[model samples]
Target: MVTTLLTPVGDAPWSTEEFESRLRAVPEERYHDRHAFNIRMHSGALSQAELRCWIANRFHYQRHLPVKDALITAKLPTPALRRMWLRRIQDHDGLEEGEGGIERWLRLGEAAGLDRETLLRGDTVLPGVRLAVDGYVNFCRLRPPLEAVAASLTELSAPDLIRTRVAAFERHYPWIDPDGLAYFRSRVPQSRRDGAEALRLVLSWAYTRKDQERAVAALRFACDVLWSLLDAVAHEHCPEGS
Candidate 1:
């Protein structure tokens, strides 16, 4: 089975640099690229119906992204930290409809022919999808600040995947309106901004060896949460061996 906890209470201890190496390892091994959904999405192999399911199911994820950030923001005691992190919620939620990442994802679903009712009601969402996302939120809410920030490190690999996804959609799924891919487009700048800040936060605050290990563990768990969700979606929605 894939490793879940980074270092439990008593495993080998990691130094700060070792922790960084482990941190890098988490995404390298467990990032969404390893996921079957990503492989199909990036290759444009999914049918339109599969694409619709992707949008509908992933809409749940988009809804929770900001909420997770808000949870983290609520935890920060300092105004400066809170102020810096609060932008994430705004970026995802946006000022109004037809804006923000969530809106863009909805457009993608519409372009894929998903009805608003089914999409909004989340009637088609897989149980594992909700579990993985909830796991992420709970981790942020319950973990130490360093670990929570480290968990956000999944954003590090997002830009590349976004680019690949857009390219695939443009090439293979021309029937899809270009506007629907906005979810990936909007994520580019926001992911970079949030990821850079999160990386710096984890590196700076995780001073001790044990703290660094915890931070790495946090990141690995976050990656698993995301990767596993995509896996669940793919298994449930995608056709045989897809």
Candidate 2:
């Protein structure tokens, strides 16, 4: 669901604010924050199993983040951009093992009563989750660097979502160790920093009408990836006492 499209049917490139506005608009309607499962989650209505399902399945996407980021890192045209982007990969993968976002997520899995090896093995990962996550990786691999980076623009909406998610978990799911929430906590500031850099790159590189449109299209596509992920999760896991 974290992959990284659309047009307003316009014929010209927009001004800087207008271009950024268009990018922001996609998530307004399409962000997975509005998904039924996520809405249920925010309401603190999800059962323990449902929450564990989300935690484990999201790990599928989480593990691939560095892979796709590495692809983006390779495509960055300059050392300055590359250096800026390398932090994203490191943030997820960590400077060393037993550190960073991926490890923190494994801890999240453990806190949800999932075994680290089992989550890493991915035996329970649904076909749809795999497909959607793989699509996200291929997107970064094959698309223009501009579009690839734009796809990551999902980070633009992430800080707020993480904020609400953390609060919801703390409020509604007290059974989960607050310590397990580090990944979400860390991402609030990290996403903000990353979102700013990504928007800058998108604005600086997407100078033409076509590229601007492609950026928007990529954002919409990212939105779809997130929605599809939730659909799969919701379909497979029924809430308690349903």
Candidate 3:
């Protein structure tokens, strides 16, 4: 188990410490880092084609990150919060063209033998992958800002995941250009910084037991989105009955 909640839900409101404990438990238990495809990926078991499929399909999700962040950014009540969240959008979209996380991700695609135009064209994206990514975007667009931020808490596990990816790619997938790993390498510190701020916001905003539970549920939904997207990719390529 990831964590044993110090306090049970449906009781009185949890103390801030206890509520935070619950949120921290989420990624430990539910983050897609534990997905089977990821397990195989880290073990250097994926064929080049399998790995490239992932790079191409995952771009479908990456390209929309700014769009999702922008939706959440607009709902922030304070200029201070909005300003802080705007950095997230800028991190992906960049201050000017031909920069930022999105471009770096395209370079990763190129290293994986996928052309940038093909990644942008979205033709390689599986139907389930499309649905999962779109669902996440819509989740931010419609849910309360608190829940949306809660969903982003998957970043809590992202730093370590990114690190593992960089190491694994360098060790296992020598066919890919090492420079193409810039996306994962840069994300290590970026995810930690982003996840910490997002966690603080969740802890502060979810002041009541109900709100805290909603945040937990939202994080669970986030885990589901990522896991489902991987399922789509794995189903298409992994050995039958895997």
Candidate 4:
């Protein structure tokens, strides 16, 4: 059902503008930022337990960010591309111990009342959440480099989401420490930079109809992955329907 919603390949190669439109269309239609779980989060409807559950499960996805980036970097064909992609890995992993997005996410977990050790160990990651994240990682590992880059175009929507989330957390979830909000705050600029680079790469590399179709499909698949992650979180914490 999700695959069926992707922009279909056409006989004629799309113009660059058309391809950009098709790529942007995925987030409008299917980005997980539209999911009910996130709507509740933004509206301050989630209970503290519900919020903690989300943070704990989402940490699993956060931990895999660099792994997926590494896979994409390994597949890049040029030193320039590899050099550009390596920044994504570093953004998540940091240059030294106890830094980067993953560490900041742990602080978020702790602020939300989740045990830091338990969060780091990832023992409570929901089954569906694990599968969705692993699927994205495997996609990066096995797909063509262009498709993998295209998948990361999900970052296009992330900066706006991070901004909204930061404001929501401050306005609604005041119990969380200000310092623990660093993860979302830090991502706003980083995602803008990363998304621009990924979009440029997709536009330049996927020049033909077939390649453009694959790029669109890859982005659609990524949307599905994120949506599935939220679906899992919702099922676990809001089973009666939020």
The candidate 3 region of ten consecutive residues with least summed lDDT is 233-242
Q: Positional deviation of 30 in candidate 4, in angstroms? A: 0.8
lDDT of 4 by residue, 1-242 (tens): 45655555655789999899999999989998899999999999988878888898889999999999999899888899899889888999999999899999999888876789888787778999999999999999999899999999999999999999999999999988889999998999999999999999899988779899999999999999999999998888532111
TM-score of structure candidate 1: 0.88
Using lDDT as the yardstick, the better of models 1 and 2 is 2
The top-ranked prediction according to lDDT is 2
TM-score: the better of candidates 1 and 3:
3
Question: Model 1: which ten-residue window has the lowest total lDDT?
Answer: 233-242
Where does candidate 1 stray beyond 4 Å? 1-18, 237-242
Error of 4 at 36 (Å): 0.5
Candidate 2 at residue 182, lDDT? 94
Over 1-242, each residue of candidate 3 has an lDDT whose tens digit, in order, gives: 59866665556788888888888898899888899999999999998788888888889999999999999999999999999999999999889998899999999988877877867888778999999999999999999999999999999999888888888889999988899999888888899999999999998898777898999999999999999989999899632111
CA lDDT of every candidate = 0.80, 0.91, 0.90, 0.90
lDDT agreement of model 4 with the native:
0.90
**Candidate 2 clash pair list:** 1-225, 1-226, 5-217, 5-218, 5-220, 5-221, 6-217
- Would you give me the overall lDDT of model 2? 0.91
lDDT of 2 by residue, 67-177 (tens): 999999999889998999999989998998799999999998887777899889998888899999999999999998999999999889999999999999999999888
Number of clashing pairs per prediction, in order: 0, 7, 0, 0
